[model samples]
Target: MSESRDRRAQFGWAFYDWANSAFATTVVAGFFPIFFKSFWSSGHPAETSTLQLGVGSALASLVVLVLAPLLGAVADRSRRKKPWLALATGLSVAATAGLFFVGEGQWLFALTLFVIASAAFFLAMVFYDSLIVDVATPADYDRVSALGYGLGYLGGGLLLAVNVAMTLWPEMFGLADRAAAVRWSFLSVAVWWALFALPVFLWVKEERDADTPSAGQAMREGVSELRRTARRIFDEKPVLTFLIAYWLYIDGVHTIIRMAVDFGLNLGFGETSLITALLLVQFIGFPAAVTFGWLASRWDTKKAIYLGLAVYAAVTAWGYFLAYEWQFYVMAMVIGLVQGGVQSLSRSYFARLIPEGRAGEYFGIYNMMGKFAAVIGPLLVGVTAAATGSARLSILSVLILFVAGGWLLTRVDARAAPSPE
Candidate 1:
């Protein structure tokens, strides 16, 4: 059970990020909303459609928020993290592949599948995050987590580039038009995601704890353990404070990532600009995440995270005034500079705080906070836009979250955790 660095196992784990990021970049952030609004919800008003999209995202996140902790607990107690991860990933792949059949005017079907796929994606991540403890030691957690995010940027970005080409130049691909190309792109993600997930499934081993009770007893004990876990977290001031800060700041970050393209669309920015900006974020994000890993080794990890939050705050402020397409590109680049940094650091930082055997349970709580934050960010933006009838104003509201999160983060003691072992 030694947590020595194993390059093959490490790469296997990191490849999962490469595998699933296709869904994040292509389907969720890039084309799906565009397709949903222009095709599926064609007849609906802009405000109504955006609101509905937010509602769907919120619902999906909420489902994950509720279930993540329970499943994480189960995975830890039974030492069945891979099984849970496999189940979630398999279902998500199926749902993503099914998107090929959701033609125009099928908003209900499209949104339903999106929700199912998104929830599965986020839930699967709980197990994946927990596995960091099982794979890499605490000393290398920052590097390892950053490696995964970097691969996510590169892998997701690469596919998105191909998707953009297929969408814009459908004739070259011998497709009917952009819509047909988009359909094929969705199918491609299914294949890409499932294919790259095999390495981890084949190579990484899930270390089981000492002989536990029967399955039924383990589940019951898991529930009891969750109650104690809650109390333990509350008693750990540093972890509690960090979670609160993360909950607030990441809400703003996720909101911006999820809604940036739609907001630009509402401003009448052309599709070319929005898509190109997304590519910029993805490509820049790769190096930026790796750089943050190095920074964490020099500057304190928490300090580096603070710097990322500062950049996010600036991005939020700039988002309010975004008018020209070039301005959007600038903002997107700035976001790329810090997006992966903050998220990767947060995961590694949290990994250092939790008890070793309870990694799944603790990371479950971490994922729940993230899922719950996702719920709020989208809802907030949608409500603001619906009320003001201006997407620009909605972008400004995210600033409050960053400001609050940063202030709370200053109170967290980065070195306040017991030995993770």
Candidate 2:
């Protein structure tokens, strides 16, 4: 494919978000947690189910956290994120499809998904994220990333809505029962993910600035690049500081993202109410994410991030006090309003400090740190919950991370928002 200079060409790139997020929606957030509880009961009670689900998720995350960088750097040097993207998305889709076959007492089915599905999902994100730098210039990256995040929310939400329709009215979808309807919801994600994911491989050109390297060459350089980027990140105080803050704060953000459904379900919300409220978040989050991007272009990016964090704190505290499922819906709306904006701005901010040629390698490290923190947050949440016998107390641990992260973020200067030359 011929290279095009127009930024709008990047629009097709953002559609990748619109493509794959259905998995995150129906399979990960909206349906699977509840489905797992009901399906894996083995006649055990709900709390036991939560404990098992938490452990499965943490194990899956641990795999991705360890391998994302090596896989990312190899893909970058090979100059084709599309192939890796295809492979990862394919694994996720296959796992989603397989979910249809899982049923009561199918604990191994859930375990299979936790391993293959989670690994593919997060590892695939490393390449997709490296594309942000490839697809957009600095001037446009804020909105481009925001657009991707927004569309992701929109796409994921749309699929979840369909899943909800199918689950709540399974007779209309030709399903046997509500549980079967829930199983079919996983099938919906598989189809949606495969169908929409074609544009990137079709339209987005992968340019490595030289001949594509072989696996041996990529691995040789991949290791070297990792070491060099690690040094650069640590030696540069501003980058180091921002990363520290980002590491800490993003822990809270991702913790909430991974655990929101389980949290709601634990609070005794009905399955329908939980999925419905989560769906509402996916839709509401779309426009809100875009709006935050626009606002960030005008305000200081860090300040914009701070605003998002502030809103998060309020929502968490409000959640701690909630008595009804109504509070979950309201808090979901509030989270949707700020979640994408904060995440998009943070990605863009990190992009600004990273050098051009090393985008993939650095983004790999970024992903490493990102997922490493991701690993810890859930582990902490799980261990704390198990020890205290209280999810409410576990929620407070996130507050400490947020405040410490914000304080670190305040010290990092956003002085290097330059486009790669």
Candidate 3:
């Protein structure tokens, strides 16, 4: 590919992040929980709603965990990463849109749609993350990965700002009320996701491997390949170690992102304040993600990741003692500084370690570990909250994940696998 085409493909791939992140910001991290509690689960106790949300999140992650590696393997063998991505995106968009029609006091219906959308959203990433190899050279992995994340934050943030405005001032948006605006926000995310996802389908071409198999053949081969890859990962010490660390730490990260709003509510913070704090993270995350990419180029990737993890540990610890809304905002600011940094670098670093032409399969496992961690993290919080009835104490359960994961990360040698230049 020419330099121009390469740049175009890179941007096209990154724009998918821009597209889908609207779901991440507008639904997953922003309005969904609030709506779930106040609208869907209207008469339920706060603790009961929190448990339901956690279980719903864990269920979504669990579905993706089971399917990610298999889908990845099949896509790899069939050479249909883009098609798979498209299918998942379409499903997610449909599911998200369906949320708008769910009636009040219908938490089960809302949760069901959320699970479907969330699962599809995560499954789409298995293909999307793998496509990074098609868009940029190995040497540019960190930069390209960071670019995707930066765009995601910016794009997600922009749409969320508009959605937040609609909720705050429903009359201006021609909506009936805040609830109507929130429903419209869900519909808006679906449109935004479908619209922006088009560039990737058009421009980011997947490289075809020789001897691609038929769909039926690929499914049979994919199952066998998944078994082999499982063995290979275990035998590869650095890969295994990094995955373990990633599983632990990223669990805390995912949990925090999913649960922060609920936590704020539990602590008596206003919904407006919590949403604003989330918006703060999105804006700050844009420049901060790019900066982390630059920092990784200057420093060791592992060290940069360690820095992010350290900050996360501190944030989780501080969350336990959080007393005021301002403190929550401060924590959000600090999290924004490192959230994208850690996630982007982990993707790039793992991209370097995996063999070529097998990105889909490897990143499948990568995402699987992530999803598995997510399962544990949310359940921990839910179980803890139900057991102790103290949201602060439940928040503290995440602290251990960061600390353990960071320590395990120390065992992985950065030089163990280097991408070919």
Score every model by TM-score.
Answer: 0.90, 0.88, 0.91
Tens digits of lDDT, candidate 2, 1-421: 2346435457777788887888887777667776777675567788888788878878887787667777776776777677888899999889878888877898777667756887788888888888877677788778888888999999998888887888778899898888888887778788888887787767666676667788799888777766665666676777788878889889888877656666776778877777777778889989998998898888877888999999877766665677677777888888889999998888888878776666666677777777757656777777878999987877766777788899999888757533333
- On lDDT, who's better, 1 or 2? 1
Query: How would you encode candidate 1's per-residue C-alpha lDDT over 167-277 as one tens digit per residue?
Result: 989999999998999989999999999999998888788887678666787688778888888887888888898899999999888888866777688779887888898
| Lowest lDDT 10-residue stretch of candidate 3 | 412-421
**Candidates ranked by lDDT, best first?**
3, 1, 2
Which runs in model 3 stand beyond 4 Å of their true positions?
41-55, 255-263, 374-399, 418-421
Better of 1 and 2 by TM-score: 1
Estimate, for each residue in 121-171, the C-alpha lDDT of model 3 and write its tens digit: 999999999999889886788888998999999999999999999988999
Scored by CA lDDT, what does every candidate get? 0.87, 0.78, 0.90
How much is 221 displaced in model 1, in angstroms? 2.1
Q: Each model's RMSD to truth, in Å?
A: 3.0, 3.3, 3.0
Error of 3 at 312 (Å): 1.9
Can you give the lDDT of residue 340 in candidate 3? 98
